[model samples]
Target: MAQSVHFSTPVDTVVSRMRALDTALPERDGLAVFNRVYLTVTEEFDRQLDAGLFPDRRAAISLDVRFAERYLTVAEDGRAPACWRPLLQFRRHPGVRPLQFALSGINAHIGHDLALALVDTCRTLGCEPADLEDEFDRVGDLLVSLEERVREELMPGPDLFQIADPLTHLLGSWSLERAREATWAAARALWALRGLPDLAEEFADRLDSAVGLAGRMLLTPLPI
Candidate 1:
């Protein structure tokens, strides 16, 4: 019989692990911090999924919870509070569409992969093919919904240029510091997703490639 999955570790244990992970992240680079945060958050989400925390085998709720905890921790950490605030603000702001779109894409990718993994695991455990088909259909519906949400977020609006302009200006002011941070965050998110099974591994690989391109863009010299 397949063993029932459960979260054996206490909540405190997960929190401690997250704290340790945060402390180990690079402190001098804002881009590094962004990458680290996204990576860490995704890992926590996967941990929750592996532990069977969600009814639907999706990572959205877990991501929200992990993100909240991370934000609280950064706000309380005196030495890094200033640096974290802007990032947190960006997350909360609706005008920063690209960041939101990127996060939504990450979430959708992970959620879809997890659902597929769960279906495969269930089949291995002797689930009937019909039931497995049903589950797959459900997961497919969810993925469609997630994709639609991502599309809506990514769609350019009248303020699209306006929103991107400020970020571009900020990057120019800091010589791509913020852009570098965004790249780092993308890398970390991909790293965290790497822990999933084969499907997730593929998704992570794609994300890794995307991050690499983004990172190169960040490092490109801006015309003076």
Candidate 2:
């Protein structure tokens, strides 16, 4: 029997899980690096919710919780998608920069899991993606803002050593804006393919694999 989708997951539960990871994981650990960045974003969302920033509080919370659950499940279960495999495999390597780990994780979560989460939210709410567009855009804006903060916080200090570094170039190659645009398109495409389960699965799998390949490249251990 197909499991029923429920939209009642409390925001506190997911926030607590993130807080626990923040306390347990080392600051420089790849998962920790990503977790810190993500945790900040989640916290901000929660504050926004309290402020009544969302027009549909239930939908916002549902989307937010569902989006987070995907990452938490992968982290705890070790059943990560291909896009997340590189970060998991290379997380502890001394050669990988903190920014690389952070961005790679973001790449995987936003690139693949985000689209699926959108679909998950839709099913739970008995609504279409169009119905949740406002929440999606608001969340996307928050992500973009957090990405800026993450870059600023993780970027190496200015110096010739930092300016000429490969990490700088590698980080420069990817853009959160482009990723967000792609994710929106993917989410809409997946929703369109809702009736064609096999095709949708194939599309999602291809997306997962492709994002994973990019993550692997991003995590290439640098001599610096």
Q: Rate the local accuracy (lDDT) of all candidates.
A: 0.41, 0.88
lDDT of 1 by residue, 1-224 (tens): 99856553333454565566558644433323344434454455556456665564423333333333433444345222222333333343334444332433233223222333433444345443343343334333443454345445544566656555544553333222233334334434444454565855675456445433433333332222
RMSD of each: 13.1, 6.3
Candidate 2, residues 17-100, lDDT tens digits: the string is: 999999988877899899988888998888788777999999999898889988998777788889889999999999888888
Top lDDT model: 2
Q: Which of the numbered candidates is closest to the native, going by highest TM-score?
A: 2
lDDT of 1: 0.41
**Which 10 consecutive residues of model 2 have the lowest summed lDDT?**
2-11
Candidate 2: residue 50 lDDT (0-100): 76
TM-score for each of the candidates? 0.28, 0.93
